[model samples]
Target: MGRNVLVVSTVDHADDTLRARIGDDVDEVRVVVPVVQQGFMDWLANDERAATHAEEEAARLEEELPAVSDARKGEADVLLAIQDALATFDADEIVVALRPDDETQFAERIAQEDLRPSVAGVPVRAVVIHEQG
Candidate 1:
């Protein structure tokens, strides 16, 4: 059997980009879009709206990348969501798609600290995609 790779990103990544990085050894690719809640008040007020948006976004991602399975993490920390996806999908590897210009300071920290050895336990690869003008 081929490897299962879990891709965690805030935005959609091109399949060619992922395929180039992961190579042809992958049997399954699952995408996880992490939901970053702004604040407690905002989350409380917009919980339903957030869920709806996440659902729609996941659906759109699936439509765009028909070969991959897409999922959303609602009202959770990105690191925890990665762990959840790892278990849920039985992933063999993790690829974090990062856009340097768009990531928050917190996101940078998480990418450095929590995303790799702490969360995944499996092999992890971070692919930085520079934002195009």
Candidate 2:
């Protein structure tokens, strides 16, 4: 048995980057791609486009990372998604990938400070990665 890590990110995690952040002894990795609703209108529209993008991103990550135990769509809010995942996925650690702070402040913008309180006990690692071009 090994440690199970939960990866919550908005971008496609490259192999090197993922390895660097996740470190060693990761027996299982469950990925959660957060659906980011663009605007209030998108939210009112049920965020169909956002949901589609999230699923596509999750699928891409799943294909890119063969060792991944599971990959699925998560809520628009990253914190909520982590909480939701923790309910079902037994995660020993959590790695959150986010855009740089200087980047646009989207709804999903989260830092280690805000994340730590939401998920107590479970250690969290946040990586500042640029969004894929």
Candidate 3:
């Protein structure tokens, strides 16, 4: 059996860096895109925009990877989504793809060092994915 990889990202999909990092060693890939609430008012209103975007993001990611086993929207918080995803995916490796040069609070939440200790001690790899407009 090959490695099961779990990816959590802010962008639409995992980039070439991911492929280069792991090569063709991937057996199964699960990509989760977090639905970040834009602001307090949007959170209160339960806006669907964020979720809609995440769903689309996950779909695009699924389309990109041939080994993708699962792709879906995760919790609003990226870290929470990664934690919850692990409960079911049983991934051997975890990849957190952060959109570089992003100034959003969502980007700030992902700390490679901090995320490493969690995820049941799985090796964590952080990669920069530049989102295209």
Candidate 4:
């Protein structure tokens, strides 16, 4: 049976790297893009019409993500979102895509922390894809 891989990316294009890493064992690749909701308080205080507009904008942002199977909002923290997605999908593997020059401290956290396996209730291999320039 093919494995289900959950790819959480901050980049615009990560499919090529992901495909190469997973090889032929992947049956399905679920993509998640974590977004931070700015001006959330203002939106909450706005009128019905403005609130509706905010909702539409949020939906649009979700649509903009590449191969987005799920968009994690409210929680901009990628690690937390990955944990949530893992529980929701029960994925066999987790891949996190980031830029080479960008330092998000996620790589260090993932390496030192045992959160992934604890949340998955099994050994979950976490792959980090640093985008090549």
Top-scoring candidate (lDDT): 2
The C-alpha stretches of model 2 lying farther than 4 A from their native spots are 13-15, 110-113
The C-alpha lDDT values of all candidates are: 0.60, 0.74, 0.72, 0.51
Task: Report the CA-based lDDT of candidate 1 relative to the real structure.
Answer: 0.60
Q: lDDT tens digits, residues 1-133, model 1?
A: 6788777665444445756776777677787766532335545465565556556665665555434765654333557767778767888888776556445434333433555554546777777766554
Error of 4 at 58 (Å): 13
Q: Which rank order by TM-score, best down to worst?
A: 2, 3, 1, 4
Clash number for candidate 2: 0
- Model 3 ranges off by over 4 Å: 37-44, 105-114, 131-133
Per lDDT, what order, best first? 2, 3, 1, 4
- Model 4 pairs whose backbones collide: none
TM-score of 3: 0.79
Flag regions of model 4 displaced more than 4 Å: 36-74, 101-133
TM-score of each: 0.67, 0.82, 0.79, 0.53
Strongest candidate by TM-score: 2
**CA RMSD of each candidate after superposition:** 3.8, 2.7, 3.0, 7.3
lDDT (tens digit, per residue) of candidate 4 on 29-53? 5665544222345334533543344
State residue 42's C-alpha deviation in candidate 2, in Å.
2.2
